[model samples]
Target: MNVCTTGCDISSIHLTCGWFSSARLINPRVFKRLRYNDCLVNNGNRLANGHTISFQYANTFRYPLSVSSVRC
Candidate 1:
């Protein structure tokens, strides 16, 4: 997942996911969740902004995946 603050540069946020992966981005200022499926090709991915953005995995999976993020 990803989080972008007000006036943040959306283009600077890069995310890559696998076939069984799902991704979302939350904007705290508007309390909205945006689903990004274009990158969904892998599995077991998660993201956190360490402030206003957080998430939870609803189900357990056996596939291994990696998590990464860039500061924007």
Candidate 2:
């Protein structure tokens, strides 16, 4: 996932998901979680200045999606 915080700058980011992955920059403490397809979630602390969150999912079998991002 990709997120643009309020005035905060994130030049670039990289993540790899064995089965699944989720990450975000919040409260100066970036949170990341990985798990299987059955279920996944990234419930980290909210940014002190609030947060901009994004999400992504890759195909397990078919066309492989390397990455996904969203701007908030």
Identify the leading candidate in terms of TM-score: 1
Candidate 2 on 1-72: residue-level lDDT in tens? 334345654322333334543242332224343333222223333322244544443444542234333122
Q: Give TM per candidate.
A: 0.26, 0.21
Model 1 superposed RMSD (Cα) = 9.4
Q: Name the regions of candidate 2 deviating beyond 4 angstroms.
A: 1-7, 19-51, 56-72
lDDT of each: 0.33, 0.35
- For all candidates, the clash counts are 6, 1
1-72: candidate 1 lDDT, tens digit per residue: 345444443222323333333244423332222244222211222233432333333335532334334444
Best by lDDT: 2
Task: Look at candidate 2 and tell me the lDDT of residue 20.
Answer: 41
The clash number for model 1 is: 6
